[model samples]
Target: MNVTETKRKVEINDLYKLSTAYDAQLSPDGKSAVYVVRKINEETAQYVSNLYVVDLETKEERQWTFGEHLHQTPTFSPDGAMLAFVSNRTKTNQIYLLPVNGGEAKQLTFFHKGASNPIWSPDGNMLLCSAGVKSGETIHTKEEQNEKKELQPLVVDRLIYKADGRGFIKDTYSQIALIHIDSGESVQLTQGDHSYAASCWSPDGTAVVYSANLSDDPDAVFTSDLYVYNIDSKETVNLTTGQGSFGRASWSPDGSYLAFLGSQEENQTVTTTKIWLYDFSAQKMHCITQEWDVDVEDVGVGDLHSWRRNPGLIWTADSEGFYFLMSDQGNVGVYHGTVEGELTPVLFENLHVYDLSVHSNGQQAVVGISTPTLPGELYTLNLTSGDREQITHLHDTFLDDVVLAGAESFTIKASDGWDLQCWLMKPAGYEEGEKYPLILEIHGGPHMMYGNTFVHEFQTLTASGYGVLYINPRGSKGYGQVFADAVRGDYGGKDYQDLMDAVDYVIREYDFVDEMRLGVTGGSYGGFMTNWIVGQTDRFKAAVTQRSISNWISFYGVSDIGYFFTEREIKSDLYDNIEALWKHSPLRLADKVNTPLLILHGELDYRCPIEQGEQLFNALKRKGKETRFIRFPEATHDLSRSGDPKLRLDRLTYIRDWFHQYV
Candidate 1:
């Protein structure tokens, strides 16, 4: 018998035992690779990450750093002698240098606001990093900022004044700076009211290419332009005409071309992101993936993976082609693309490739992948021979002792004749003829796709005798642009029918599913759908809506992304179409809800603020509907994914208990 058969099912606290490996980086010489592994410290209820290096030739792994703090963004020097990374070991994030041979790591930056995204210069004598600084404030030590602690009222004037995880936006802007590695001396590069990101030094180390919005009214404009900043002359030149949002600029190996991923639609959120290349010699820019209908970024949604960075475009030695990640048909995979618009599959599979790094020759690559059974691990891929090998066994032993339900993928036509990809996970100990409770899970980001990735919550639900069902509905990504943008302006219309059709198909096809004991739960956009579903039909016995929006009229003014997202999604503003917004709101149909609904929300979630949940709860209470509200204090929109460890466990417990009681 299999060891998993003798072992136990997955528990809620099993989250603490899981480990995630991401941010894989290949050495310059391609002999070895380094990555970061993160795990939860149960005592502190926080995540601690450490750097690890593995020899490609010997297949031996060694731990490079040890601590309770985060050590991420590990990049090797030009000559592959030392590694530069960002760490918060001193209570503030700063740049640190470690020698590959052997020695104590050295601290490099002392900016008061903290520094991140460390990039080594080509000559290895300097490092380019980013830190926050007020327009008129000079660089100061951390001690100076600690001395001032006066409470002041925040004054807001910009249109984009706040964010979800981050609170009120201050006057500080993220600026780029150059730090000399030997003396630790720093010089501010680009400084103004605007912010810069995805900055990298030119091959010759004389200039930098970065993404920023330098328009007059940056708050109102949604365009991100690429600019080149010269170090010696202190002059800036605009690369892109500022028609769209672009970033992740990467220079080719020969420094003749620049490749990046972006969308040309100014403020539209559903436009497909494509790869664009800039020719330095010709001073021209063109889209490389114009014919391809896939999004050039990872859109897979999962709770366990945290801090997964996008490895934009890794160039080959020839500078004529590069490798990139694309989301298509419910999976994110690596694809090879050339400047002439030829795209080939490099490692396309039914998995999530979250991070990637390629060798100088481009024949080998290190990819971070995750599946339904595996949380996350690093794998080495041979580009030429198409051979793949798992280099890290982080969860092998843990998985051997746990019975994880495998997902079965299928395609079904929606009510509107659209093909929808769906997955079903049977209960852990499902018998052939035994009827099991079914739970339909919805994903957030109405545009984000749910693929064959590991979700701890789904596993726990299946372990508790509930069959889990999930689908990438009409509004989800990984499909073409039309499918992703279809749900816009019609939230509860066709999208609602698509979800209902999925439930109907599953119940009719699978005799083991208990249709009468059905449950539905989703967060954000999924939360909205759950509320809408319960209000529309009484088929579901229990429903849980998390960080949901009930009233679009109020959501427009309350949520951080409410004003723009409402206009873009609902295609209506308060002044023009109040009735349309109200028609789509779940609270408008509160009197029709009969399901035992549980509302969960994060108090500090600005994206879908807590007020949205309170409004629904009050509406349901006024109508005497079966509803209960639970609020997590000090938690943000990221509560389900990267929140406090204890809170995450409590959340999973609450979800499981609610379903067990009602379903």
Candidate 2:
């Protein structure tokens, strides 16, 4: 092969491909798979997702869904005769059935409430799906509503809940429903004035084991419990009764036992829950991998796997051994485990892994893998031999000419004496004795982690001729819970020290860093930290904060989950200790800031509303500090991840320009 072929890259417009890749589900026999393809066009300003099926043996592919309507979540019936999926072709998300052999699809349900999570019964006669309307909305027939109580204002108990991202105006409750294939009538499985979701049909198809916070205090929406609904007995049983978050419950294929994930109620610290398995015969429960050594990443253990199915737990064909995604060092990989505790590695990813789906045959799988230098693409993996093959070439062309930077790993001791692992990505063509601007990048979820994987933004920023330093710092996962929770009640205390220490260590050791031209940027919680950093110190020349929080007092009432998250993380209640919140608010120290700051926000961002951006920008402006704010109208909290492809590229360009201009 030519050298050019060896370095060949893919692009978004490649025929039969997409700019963004998403869910891929394999056929029962593992001989075929259908995946969702997302296309982004520069000319039409169009982005669309369509369904396509690939025949493994024949290498033949065909489009299964068409038209302007979007389709997703396609599943083949057990017998492999029909394809069932949820689509918005009719302008509402509804379930439809089509003969896989070939032909038009038949629309099933007709409720104005709409439907979601289309799961076919094992026998393929009845489809077990979750259908609902908006919570607290009056569910009345057209005639009844015309003659009865005009809709009253909906009152919600919880501080945070999900609003439908798309579909018709929802005015109903969320609940699990059973769709009769013949009659098309959806029977209310579990019903109440309260909301419930994330359900899976039991092994015997007689009931559904799901997680809910129905009885949980609305103000405190974190607690949940495992509840089973019996279709035959018309009974709902609280299996693992407690005020804990229990989720992703799956039944053993034999119906002899059930497996799920749960954490204790003792502390509010964010950590991975153990995989819990309960045997009906013994009426006892045991955690599959409770050791400090392992963490659950996906769903079931064996051949076919399912994660939390959008809402709750559901079992898979391979329940004999549990399989989960985990990270050790910087590597994230798949591991195999027996329900009794025997566990082994399947795939230790050298890059970030996503979209991992297993086949019932237990021999093959598909996943999206990325390294610090790579974007992401689908790859096929062989289970037995640990072999991997690239299945999709999504963006090779844009990357070919771009000389990407690779990660250089190192470590430093935090001021608190804790050893902190760190990594640096140098710009392409980096040379010794050349001074370079540096950007300290932090990740969000303070509970989430950044591992050894390909991050496009990291590469893109480096290519713009700057060194990027990313640190997990304290409160990051992968390390034990103690280390992860080190900054719990202390936001800018030790965790802030850990970050500054990393920068100090780098500045002391790396002569190429122009300390006077330093910059800092992060998103979400990272955004909060960025705002805090600029306010606390004027060491950095420039700063950028994305989806950030400025004032803790206002965040508690404005941002989604701000009501609960602030109380838990910031540990200051508005009415009880409003002073502490003011002290911790990044805006409080705005007077100390001299660095030029840029605030990027999404208008539809309920997670950390755009008001946070306005507050920070207004604060810096009032203090006579340089500040700018840009907002994406249709974007949400995922402005970086699932934002418009063109806009995502534009945001990266903006960040690069701001840093280059000031630093």
Candidate 3:
């Protein structure tokens, strides 16, 4: 086929056709790897994830398990004889097992709140998982209550009584449980008012390491201490001693040490996640990445697969060190870290390694990588030589007909003398001498980076004949802790100038960008910046803000994270610095916004509640300014990334149409 013939514009609906790979787990022999590939069912408009296995030797791949429901968290048995995964096919999500060689999956558990994160015991005769149940109730009783016909009023008691996606916080607490494979019997391991996080299976199979606050008031404390629970003795021992928030536990091959990722800082959200090693002999914890400036996980946010979880701490066979993904600058790379605080780059490239799995021999590794042009795919790599071979052709057929824009990364010095990293994606089918409208895109997280990853929204904007400009402003991770923390107390100060300077750099340097037809858009922190940008200047013709924060005063009480996030990030308290909070609030300057703005928010978004959008929309409308607000029902703060498939598409459509209408 000719070059132009291969370049077809990517459509919004193409989101349904793209397949995403996640969580690759290598077998004990390292000859095979199984991972979850998620795709949208066009007919049902729902995301369905199924297990897929790949032969590492011949590079042959096949679907290992299939069902209409979501299948995820695939883990290999100790003997590599069976594969256990969590599936929602049953009435509730439960553990299911399928023989490695070949067989139908057998449902293993029937817990009321379902089971997840299945880890097989060393003996391969049992599995350990977590399931939510009432504080003092049995699974059967809870299931029976759920199956009851009569309706009852919901009683709220806990300080944290509600979550964004989950409307009301039920009394159920996630507990650790052990399930026998042969007898189909399950035993509860730990139970309390507190919920347990994911755990690591001890090498000898006698214990499991888990994390929980276990505090008298969990909502009042930010500590998540690691604990070891003896399966035989049923005794729990605290490992972290409530020093800091810690989780993502990984046991050494010989069980001499346990490694996890966390921070001991008081300002938890702004603190960088570093690797911590707990020595069994000394009974002490050491921060292995204390000198390392990078964030020790995949925090480079994206829309296509924001639900994607980091591979966590993957231990090498010898237990001398481990391989982990660290966010530095604009890339998340796999790094080999020694127990002695040394980090060696293994796969440090202009790519996002979201998840990875190393072989038992530590010679071969499977990685989930995404680039600006590539959505996401699984690739097998030779750890010694760093040679990678793409093993899956999931979206090959679909991407063949898609025309992706060329992304160029550049660095510009902000007015405050900080080097800001930015990327510019040219519009698809660009001609040599033609000028196109540009959309200045800001990423949420003010802490998240606009890295070298595939962002579907940016692609969709480029496909619609717009150049996309995205920058990693201050307060954005990957650029050292200092640069990331720079915006904590100065939200609209230097960070705002970094974005403006990035836009000016592109407009001044790039000849093909139309200066008159400028557009701006972002979600969350990006949304907050978009609101601030239009208020500060009317250079952009239009702007779209999603799940944005408008008023810090009200946000302190209304947002799920309002109380602390406001005090921590903004460095302002409602009682003392109420005026300062209002000063930085975008809603305070709403009367100055002249650019046609569109506010999109999730109705159930507790992170940045819909009230934030409502306030902005009301302010602009009451002033007779051009503005619009669109709310996605039952959608949470993750609407752009993991919300309903249709709603995500509609949100993209709204963004494209809004920019088209003004810019």
Best by lDDT: 1
TM-scores of all models? 0.98, 0.89, 0.97
Candidate 1 ranges with C-alpha deviation above 4 Å: 1-4, 140-148
- What local lDDT does model 2 show for residue 657? 83
Clashing pairs in 1: none
CA lDDT of each prediction against the hidden true structure = 0.90, 0.71, 0.88
The clash numbers for all candidates, in the given order, read 0, 18, 1
Ordered from best to worst TM-score, the candidate numbers read 1, 3, 2
Lowest lDDT block of 10, candidate 1: 137-146
Off by over 4 Å in 2: 1-18, 67-69, 134-172, 298-319, 399-401
At residue 266, candidate 2 shows an lDDT of 45
Write the number of the candidate with greater lDDT, choosing between 1 and 3: 1
